[model samples]
Target: MNNKRRIDQTEIAEVSKIDTYKSIIESLLFVTGEPLSIREIGTIIRCNERETLEIVKEMEKDYKNRSRGIKLISSNKMLQLVTKPNNSEYVQRLLKTNVRQSLSQAALETLSIIAYKQPITRVAIDEIRGVKSDRAIYTLLEKSIIKECGRLEVPGRPILYSTTEEFIKYFGLDSMESIPSLEDILNNFGEMSKNLKSE
Candidate 1:
């Protein structure tokens, strides 16, 4: 009986520790207002990355099941808390502006190209699009949807651009692998063109 009692106590302590960790994670995410890498979170919570990822995954499931207004989003092993997309309208209304404005056709095209062919140079993007993408690239950079990833190791050494974490969150993707296949995106391009023309 005493052994059973000790076992129960141990289990209770473990559960309490997990709960504490969850609470700490919630506070960290809320305060940071930015994505935190799993390793960073693990360091703070005093757990290994694998264990931290498991806890975060559990929290994500719980938040979804609870139908919470805020949800956890992750990409590139980084996690952040964000309002549900369905609640964007209310958020925008409160902000008195389109906080999540739709991208222009040019910007969308440029973003798509960068997302799929990341670390690509501007000249390469221009070659693919058959037009200079300076304006579109500028807009994407301003919006933080894309960023300078590096400079190509060529004679000219032009800067390379890649999609950012904000891009993943904007597209409601968990990771780069979550992006639709190139063929799928190509299939949808026709519809996108039609919608853009209509606008």
Candidate 2:
């Protein structure tokens, strides 16, 4: 008699390659609820951006046909697999929780000033607001709503901060051109600068 080896064909008996891959996909999803850049996702997954992006796209297809509650969404240069908003009420009702944060009225005002006048310096923001915006700028940077666009070609060569891609998406704007008219700006503006100068 000859002895033969048997494979454990049970579905859940052993972890499969597909399962490992899905685990990676699931983990990538947990890193952020917002759409993440391919480079960022790759760094987390320990893979090249192209490979990670392909896997994500495939995972998105699988998610669509399955009963899984999460859906992978790609927008611009980012990818996000999030719980469908339609399920938000049920999820919230069951969890009895909400997770959200927003800028203060002052921070909002300061950011608006920068949005209209970037690539602009902090001093200019202070000039328009008539107050120091160090803290507000710090907050905006921390939130990734604004970033250092470049350094101004002036005496101090102050670092210029401009709105980030997140800023546009958060405001539901396609681009800066849609930021509203000067009249709209005037109406919404809280302060103005007397020595208005641009570099």
Candidate 3:
């Protein structure tokens, strides 16, 4: 008798119900909302780089055969999920790109600082970077990146600046908790103030 142990149907059913590879791929696909790279997908799913490539190959073929509403798109290192090209126009109308006004780098930076340290004041922001951020703050206020959170207890009762829901949406964050932490910001932010001073 062969000694190979058979994986039970229940186990198979559970795994099938929550297929690690497929689920991870779908999750990554959803996050990207466009073509994603194999490397990026693997990094997001915490999977082996080569294994992620294999998974995407299978996923792409499966979607093609089944004709699902969402399909896998593999372009360069960017693997994103998109509606079939035939249906892109309809989807585009439904989700038109917001072309009202875009923000500049200074505006985005001012917004980020307020976001990470909400209920902060202009003075505090200036202290951090050792420069006046009045223009940047005004720009952010105009863009609704920041709003008056509340009044502080000091003599001047300076208006505290905090990020708005629109700020979260603009930055693709689900909520405040979803925004990266201060430490994460330090790690990821690339010379935010240094560039600001140069400009």
Candidate 4:
């Protein structure tokens, strides 16, 4: 009976450790406000990939059971904590106040190009905009609306840029697909600004 009791205690301690890991991962996701790859989580938590994925899955289940405004989303094996779709209106209201800095027209133009032609290099952006866009790219990077996604497999291996999750939040978009097509924007850039402002 004493041996059985020790076994039960050991099981309980193991469960507790799993719970602690879940909480730690939850806090990290909440703080970062961006997608975290399994490798990134493993590095932060000092765990292997399998262990990190297990804890993340467990935490996802727990969040599903409990009523919470935020939930986990996975894209391309990257995990991100985001407000539930049902709570988007409320989240947008709060975000608007916090994100009051107006975007310049140059920045808007650059951002529009990126949103449509993501994974594009700086040279492509310049070609589209018909001028240098270094400052606009820098501003967007500073605002976290865009991020360096990867490097193009060409000579010089220029950095490829793409929209961040923050971009969706900023535009109150359901997803990247929600953005109007390039044709729509080309037909009427002013219309896009008006619609975004109304949102």
User: Mind giving the per-residue lDDT tens digits that candidate 4 earns over 9-83?
Assistant: 999999999998888888888886556778888998899989988888887887795588778875445777766
Identify the superior model by lDDT, candidate 1 or candidate 4: 1
Residue 14 CA error for candidate 3 (Å)?
Answer: 84
- Tens digits of per-residue lDDT for model 1, 38-123: 89999988899999988888788778865689988776687778788789989999999867667888889999889888889999
The parts of candidate 2 lying over 4 Å away from their true place are 1-100, 185-199
Residue 124 accuracy (lDDT) in model 2? 90
Give candidate 3's error at residue 16 in angstroms.
Answer: 79
Q: For residues 74-123, could you state the per-residue lDDT of candidate 3 as single tens digits?
A: 64444666566677667767769653246766666777677777789999
> How far in Å is the alpha carbon of 137 misplaced in model 3?
1.3
Tens digits of per-residue lDDT for model 2 on 78-141? 6566676678888888777652246776679889988888889999999999987876776677
> Runs in model 4 with CA error above 4 Å?
93-199
Best-fitting candidate, scored by TM-score: 1
Q: Which ten residues in a row have the lowest lDDT in candidate 4?
A: 94-103
lDDT by candidate, in order shown:
0.85, 0.73, 0.71, 0.83
Candidate 2: give the clashing pairs. none
Alpha carbon deviation, residue 1, candidate 3 (Å): 99
Whose lDDT is greatest here? 1
Q: Using Cα atoms with residue i matched to residue i, what is each candidate's TM-score against the true structure?
A: 0.53, 0.44, 0.43, 0.53
